[model samples]
Target chain A: MKKFLAITLVLALVVLGVAAKVKPIKLGAVLPLGDITGRQAANAMKLAVKEINAAGGVLGRPLELIIVDDEMNPSKGAAAIDKLATIDKVDFFIGGMSSGVHLAQIPILKKYQKITVWIGAASHLCEKALAGADWYFHLHPWDYQQGAGYAIGWKQILEKYPQVKFDRVFLAYEEGAFGTASYKAYLAMLEQAKQGEGPYVGLVKEFKGESFKSAAFGGGDYRAVLRLAKEWNPDAFIWAGYDADALPMMAQAKEIGFAPPIFIGAPPGWPADFGKSPLSEGVVLYGMWAPSLNKVSPVAEHFYNAYVKEFGEEPATYFAPLGYTNVYFLVEGIKKAGTLEKEALIKALEQVEYESPLGETLKIAPSAVIKHQGFTTQKILQWQNGKQEVIWPFEVQTAEFIYPFPKWEGR
Target chain B: MKKLGMLIILAVVALGFLFPLYAGPYPLHVMTTVLTYMALGLSWDMMLRTGQLSFGTAGFFGLGSYAALLTTLYLGLNPLASIFVGGVFAAIVAFALGYAILRLREIYFAITTLALAGVFTVVARNLHDFTGGPEGKILPSAIFNGDPTKVYWLTFSVALGSILVSELFQRTRIRFAITAIRNDEITAKSSGIDIFKYLLFVFVITSAIQGVVGGAYAQQYGFVSPESAFSTNFLLLPIAMCLAGGIYSTLGPVIGSVILGVLSEYLKLRFPYGHLIIYGVIIVAIVLFMPHGILGMLKKIAQKTRTEVGGNENEK
Candidate 1:
C-alpha cells in the first residue's frame, strides 16, 4: 500500500510537470457560439487558427485559440470578455458578429487594455470611441462607407429609370449605436445631394423594446411605415437594422404592395435568405465586403479558393473574408512586432501598414479611436434568382445592377 | 427550543449583513447573489411548509423585474420605491392566481406554476412595445452609482430583512397552521383550520418576497432582459442549492446556496465547457450521501455522541 501511494504521488507530479510545459500564446476569440451569427464566425475563426499554427506561426510560437461562448446576450458577452481577461489570461481578443453584443464588450475591453480586433461588427461610432490602450481595431467598414456605397448603388438604380423621380425617402432603423450612426450618415449624404432635395427622406424612425411600433416617435407597427410609404410615394425606402428586425418588416412590406422602386438595407438582412420569396429580387444592400467578387490579388484568390475547397461551398457572405483578413492582419502585426510583449506589439501595430484582400492597405493610428488609413470600399451586391451578384464599383462589377426587379407577375 | 434557534439564526443573520463591509467586490457579488437566492429559497420553503410547491418563482421574478423597469421608465421613480411596487405587483398577481389554482395539490400545482412562467415570458415578449422583448433593457448606472461593493452591501441588507421576516412568520400561529396543513390538510380543516385561506396567505407572502428580491437583482445589475430574468439558470440553480444544502429548512438553503454558488463560479472558469456537468456531479454526491442535508446529518452525529456519552456514564 505504501509503494502504491508513492507511485501515485510520482504520477501526479509528472502530470503537473507536463501541464506546466504545455504553454502556448493564449489568444481569446469571444463570439456568440450558441447563436446564429457565431455559427459562421466561430467555425471560420477556428479554421484560421488551425491554418496559422500549421504554418511556422508567429514569433516562433504556436498560437492557442481560446473561445468563449457569449450565447448572443450582451451581458454574457461582457462577462465572457471579463473571464477571458481575468481567468483565461489571454494575450489578445477577437470575434463578434452582433453589434449589440459588440457594444456590450467594448467597456470591458477598454478596461483590460487588451488588443481587440473586431471580426464583423460595423458600429462605427462605438468603434471610433473605444478607450483603453492603442489596441482596439476593426477590419470591417463603418456605416459611412456602407451607407455611401449603397447610395452609389442607388444612383445606378435611378440612372436606369429617368422617370422614377420621387418626392421622399423615409428611414427606419434599429435603435442602437450602429443603426443610429448609419442612418444619420445616410440622411446627411442624401440631404447634401439634390436627389430628393425638396422632400428628401426627412422622416426617421427608431424603435425600442419589443413594441412593433415606436410610440414615442410617432411610428406604429410595420403597417404604419408601409402606409406612410404608399401615401408619400417615396422613390425608395432605407432600413438600417439587422436580419432579425428587417426580414419580418420586409416580408410585410412586400405583402402590402409597397415595394419601393429602390430598397436598401444595412448589412443585417441584406441579401437576406428570401428562399422562395419573390420580393428579394433587385433589393440592393450594403455590406463591408462580398466574397463573390473576384479580386485582382493572388493572395485573395488563394484564400477564396482555399475557403471553398475547405468549407464545401462558396463563402456565403463577406463575414468569412473579414475573419480571414483580420487573422492575416494579426499575423502581420505579430511578425512585425518580433516580441509578444503588449507594448512591443502595440508599437508594431501603430507603425505597420499592409494591403489586405479587401483591396486596402490598413494603417493604424495611436489614438484611442480605432482608425485605419485608406478609403472604405464595399462591393455592392444584388440578389438575382437564388444567388447574390456583385453589381457595383464598376471596376469589379460582376453583373449590371438589376434595376426595377422584373415585377413578379405572380403577385 | 424554537426561541433559542431564533436567537442563533438572528445572530448569524446580523453577521451575514455585516460581511460586505470587509469582503472584496467579487466575493461580495457572489454573496449578494447568494442572499438573493436565500430570500428566494426561504420563501419557497415558506410555501412548502404549507404543502404548496411552486416552480413558477421565475414568473414572479420576471414580473417584478419588468415592473421595476417600467416604473422607472414611465414614472421615473426612485429605484427603491420601484422595487417595492414591483414586489407588490407580483404579490397581487400571485393572490389572484392562488384564488383559482391553489386548490390543486402536488404535481398539478407545480406544473401549472411552471407553465405560467412560460406564459409570463410570452407576455413580456409580446409587450415588447414596453419590455425590450428578447433583447431586454440596459439599466442606467446612475442608480447604483458604479460601485459593486455598495450594491453588495445593499443586497446583503435586503437579504437580512427577508430572512428576518421569514423567521418571524415561521414562529407565528400561522406557522402552526401551515405545519398542520402540510401534514394532513383534511384533518386540519376538520379541526377548524381554513386550508385555502392559509395557503393563499403563504402564497401571497412568499411571492411578494420573491418579487422584491428579483427587483433588487435588476436594480443591482443595471440591466434586465426577459431571458436572463426568466432564465432556467436562475430558477434551477436556487432549487438545486436548496436541495443540496437540505430542503425545507432555513439552514439548509443558506448553506446550499453559498457552497453551490461559489463552486459553480469557480468551476465555470476552470472548465467552461463542462462546468454544468461538474455542478451536477457535486449536487448528486451531496444528495446521495446526505439525504437529511448537512444540518440534519450534524444533528444525527450529535445525537449519536450524546448516547455514547450516556453509555460511558452508566458504566462509570
Candidate 2:
C-alpha cells in the first residue's frame, strides 16, 4: 500500500510541475485608450491573442496581453511602462500611438530592455530618441519616410495618368507639432527637388506652405490659409491637420470655391462619417491601409469580418490591422526561435516576413537610425462613392485615380 | 500630543526617504510623480496666501523647463546646475512681471497670468532654431540614466524643500503680513505692511519653486516639447490637488497629493477603460461633500471629539 501511494503522489507532482512550466507569454501594451486609434488597436490585439490561444498558442503555451492606458500624458505614459515591466512582469512590450507619449516611454523601455514591437509613433524625433535599440522593432514609417512615400506615390500617379498634373503643390498645415513637422518634411523635400537628388526631383516644381490653427485646438478658421492657397492656385492642395478640421475645412473650401486639381486631407484619422459626406468625393488622402484592401487580401477580409462580428463596429483605423500584426508577428518570431530566450528571439524576429493585412509583406530593414524598421511606405487613396479607393501602389489598386477634384457647384 | 505628532512627521519623512529600498520601480515612479504634483500644489497654495489668484504655475514651469534644457544643450551645464538656472530664470521673469501685473488686483491679474503660458508656448514654437520648433528637444539619456531610485530621491528632495518653504511661510512674520493683506489689502497697506513687497516676494519664491520642479521633470524625462512642457495639466492638476487637500496649510496639499495621486493610479489599474470617469466622479463628490477637503474634515472631527470630552469632564 505504501509503495502504490508513493508512485501516485510523484505522478501528481510531475503533472503539476508541467502545468506550471506552461505559463502564458505576457505582452504588455501601453496606449492612449481614450483615442480611437489606440482603442481599436487594443481591441485588435485582444482579438489576435484570442485567436492565437484558440489555435493552441505559440509553442503550445497561451498568450496573455496586459494593456495599460497612458492617458496621453507623458508622466502617466512613463509610469505605465514601469507598471508593465516591474509589476506585471510581462515577457514583451507592444503598442504605441502618440509620439509625445512614446518619447516619455523610451527611457523606461530602455531600462527593461524587453523585446518590443511598436505599431505607432511616426515622429522622426522618436527614431532619434530610440538610438538604435536592437530589441525595439518599429512598424510605422517615420515622418520623413511618409513624406518621401508621398513624393514617390505622386511620381507613380503622374506616370500612370498622363492627364494628371501636380507641378505646383501648396500645403496648409496646422500650427502644432504634427503639422509643423509635416511642413518641415515638405520643405526638405522641396530642397531635395531643387538639388534633383531625392524622390521629389522632377515631381514638385513649386511648393508653398502656410500654417493655420486647427479647429481641434480651438481655432477653426481655415479661410486665411485656404484663401492664400487659392491665390497660389497650385495644382495640388493639401492640409495637414486633425480630423475635426476635415468636414469644416471641406465646407469652407467649397464656400470660398477653392477646388484644386488634387484636394487632399492628410489627417491621421478621418471622421467616421467623412465618407458619407458629398464633399469627400475625389478627395485624395494618404494612409497605410483602407477597408477597400479587404477585397484584394484574404487576410484583410478575414480580419475585417472577424473584427466586425466580434466588436460590432467596423475597424476604422489602420491601427487595427497593425495592432493585429503586432501580435502575430511576434508569435511568428517566437515560433521560429522555439524558445523565449532574448538573443535567440531577437535573431528570429530579424528574419520574420509577416504577410500583413496592410497589403504588404512586412520585412525588417535598416532605417536611417534603427536596424529593424517595417512598412516604410504608405498608400495613396481617394474618397470615391463613399469609400476610400486605393489609387497608387498598383499591385493593391482598388480603383483608378480620380483626378480634378469636382467643382462645388454641383451635388 | 505635540511630541507624538512630531514623531509621526519624522517617521513619515524617514519612510519616504527609505521608500526606494523597499519598493519596486513602479511604485517609486508613481511616488515621484506624486511628489512633483505635491510640490506644485504647495507652491500654488503659497501664492494664493497673498490674496492674489495667480495662474502662472504652468507658465513658470514651462519657462523653467526650457531654461534648464537650453542651458544644458547650449552651455553644456551640469544637469543639476541647469535646474538652478531654471529656478533663477523663472524668478527673474516673475520679479519683472510681478511689478506690472501685481498692480492689477483680483480677476484681471489672474487673467493676465493665465495668458502667460499661451504667450510662452507661441514664442517657443516660433523660435524653431533654439527650441527645436514644435517637435521639441531630447536628451541623449534620462537623468541618472533612468535609475528609478535616484529619480525618486531627487523628486522627494524637491518636494521636501517645498514643504520646508511652506512651513517657513507658516511659522514666520511673512505669514502675518500675507494674512493681513489677504484680509484687507487697503488696511494692510495703511498698517505699514508694504503689501506690494510681500506679494512680489511670495510670487517670486513660488515661481522659483515651480521652475525648479519643472527643470527636474525635464531632466527626468530627458525631453521637453512646447506642448508637453507647457501643458495645462501642470496648472490644472496641482490646483485640483490643493483644493482636494484643503487650501492654505502645508499639510493640506501634501495629503491631497498622496490621496488623489495614488487613487488615480489605483483606479486606472482596477478599471482601465472606465477609470477616468470614475476618478472624475470621485473628485467631484469629494469637493462637493467635503468642501474643506479630507484634511479639513479630519481636523473638524478631532476638534469635535476634544470638545465632547471636555464637556463631559466639566460635568463630572
Candidate 3:
C-alpha cells in the first residue's frame, strides 16, 4: 500500500511538470545579413534572446528567433515575410534595414497584421505606408524627425556657444533616394526656418542644396560640387551620400580648399578606420548611439561589453544596440501581458518604458503618421582623436565641441 | 516522342495551375517569384534567338512598373487594366527606341540597352511631381489585397503566356528568319528576309512581355521605386537563368528557374550567414563545367547513347 501511493504521487508530479512546459514564442526577423548593420543586429538579437532565456524567458516560455536574410532585395524581403508568417508561424515580426525593402514588405506585413517592431527604415514614406498599423512599432526615427533633431541640436549648440555661427548652410546630396529625400526634408525645414516656425527658425538663415552623383554609383569626381560649395562659402557644409564617398569627398574638398566653419558628413555608415583619418577630425555627424555612450550609461556599457564578449568584435553600428533593445522591449511587453494575446500585448507594449542602450528612454509615442514611434532624436557627434564623441545632448556629452574645422595645410 | 514531350508540357502546366491548392503562402510566394523570373528569362531568350545580346530587360521592366503604378495612381485606372497599359507603354517605347538602336549590333547595342536603365532612373528621379521623384509611388493596397493564391495564379498565367509566345516563335516562320539572322545577318538579308523588321518585332514583343511581368510584380508588391523598379537584378538574374538552363529555348529557362530558384531558397535557409558566397560559387561552377547548360549536356548524352546503340546493332 505504501509503495503504490508513492508511485502514484510521483506519476502525478511528472505529469504536472510535463504540462507546465510551454512552447517557445517565436520571432521572425528578415534582415540583410550581408551588410554590417544587419549582421551585427542579428548577432545582437541572438545575444538578447540568450540572455532572456537564461533569465527564465518571457512568460515562462523561451523565445525562439528565426532569422532570414533579405539579400538587400525588395522582393526577397517581402518573400521572407511570407515565409516567416506562413511557414514558421512566428508570433511576432521584427528586423528591417532599407526603406525600399521595407516598403515592399509593408503589404505582406499588413496581410499578417502581426505585432511588428522594426529598427530601421527611416524614410518618412515608410511611416506614411504604415500610417494606421497600430500593431507596428518603429524604433528608428523618420527622416523628418532626424532632420528636426539636427535642427534642434544645432540650435542648442549655437545657444551654448555664441561664438559659433551657422547662418548659411550648403547641402551636397547624392542623386539617389536617400540623398534626395534628405535634401527635400532640409528644403522643407529651410522654408519653415525662413517663416520662423520650425526647429531651425533661429539657426539657419539661408540654405542651398545641390545634387552630385555618388561615388558608390560610379561617379567619384566631386570637384564640381566642391567648387560650388567653395564659391558659395556657406557657414556649414554637409554632404549626404554613402560611405564610399567619404574619403574621396574629403580629399576633393581639401584639394579645392572648401573648408567651412562646420563640415558634416551624413552617410549611413562610415568606412572602417575613418575615425583614424585626420580628415575625420572636427567633422560633425548625426547618429543614434556611439560607443562613447558606454562611458556615460551603464546600460550602454553592459550592451557593449556583452556584445564584444559574445561576438568577438565591437558593435560597429547603432543597429546592434537597437536590435538588442528590440528583443528586450518585446519580451518585457510579453512579460507584462503574461500571454501572447495580441491586444493585451500591444497594450502592455504601449505602457512599457525601456531604458535603451542608445542613451535614451524609449517610450511609445506618435509620429506624423505612425502611432508608435521610438527614439525621435539623434545625437550630434564629432570624430575627435580617433573616436566618435557626443557633442550635443549635453546630458550625455562625451567630449567638448571643436570650434571651427581645421585648415587643410597643417594636418 | 514528340507527343510524349507535349503531354509532359501539358502536365507541368496543369500542376503549376493546381500548385496553390496544396502549397502554403510561402511556397506560393516563392513560385510567384520563380514565375516572374521565368517569364523574364523566356523573353530574354526570345531576344537572344535573334542573335542580339539586349540588356534592356530591366529598363523596360522599370518602365512598365512606373507606367502601371502611375496609371493606377494618377489616372485612377483599375490595377488589372493598368498591367495591359504597362505592356502597351513598353511596346510603344520599344518601337520608337528600336528604330534608332537596332541599327547598331553586337556590343554597341548591348551597351546602349544597358544604359537605358540608368537613363530611365535619372528621368524618374527628376520627375518629382509626376513620378514622386526618388521616393517613388505606392499603391493604396496590393492587388487582390495580398492574396497569395490569386497572386500566384496571375503570375502563372503570365509565365504560361510567355511559354506559348516562345513556342510560337519556335514553330512559325519567325524561327527560320531568326535562325538565319543569327547564323549570318548579311546572308539572311540577301535571302529576302527583312532583318531589321524581324529584329524590331522581336525586340518590341519581348519588351512588352518584360513590361507585363514587371507590372504584375509591382502590382503584387504594391509599390514602385526607381531603385527597386529598375534594379539590375531584372536583367542579370534572367540572363543567368537562361544561360544555366540552355539559352534560346522555352524549356531551358523553365528548368533553370525551378532549379536555381529552389536551390537559392534552400541554400539561404540552410546557410544563412554564408549562403550568397556558396550560391555564387555553385553558379560559377555550373557555368564553368557545363558551358552548354544542363539541357544541352542532356541532349549530347542522349545523342551519344543512340549512336552507340546503332553501332552495336551494326556489329551484331
**lDDT per model vs. reference:** 0.67, 0.94, 0.92
TM-scores of all models? 0.65, 0.98, 0.98
lDDT of 3 by residue, A1-411 (tens): 999999999999998987577788999999999999999999999999999999888777889999999999998899999999988999999999999999989999999999999999998878888879999999999999999999889889998988888999999999999999999999888888777788887788888899999999998999998899889999999999999999999888888888898999999998988988898889988998999998899999999999999989999899999999999999988888888999999999999899999998889988988899988989999999988999989999999999899888876
- True lDDT of residue B277, candidate 1: 77
Model 3, span B1-316: residue lDDT tens: 9999889978988999999999999899888999999999999999999999999999999999999989998999998899889999999999999999999999999999999999999999999989989999888898998888999999999999999999999999999999999999999999999999999999999999999998999899888999999999999888888888888798889888988888889999999999989988988888898887888888899999999999999999
lDDT digits (tens) for residues A74-122 of candidate 1 = 5456667766776678888987776556655665566577777777555
List of clashing residue pairs for candidate 1: A169-A201, A210-B128, A210-B129, A211-B128, A211-B129
- Per-candidate clash tally: 5, 0, 0
lDDT for position B119 in model 1: 82
Chain A TM-score by candidate, in order: 0.74, 0.96, 0.96
Predicted model with the maximum lDDT: 2
Worst 10 residues of 1 chain B by lDDT: B139-148
Per-residue alpha-carbon lDDT of model 2 for B214-315, expressed as tens digits?
999998988999999899989998988988999999999999999999999999999989899998898899899989998999999999999999999999
Chain B TM-score of every predicted model = 0.93, 0.98, 0.98
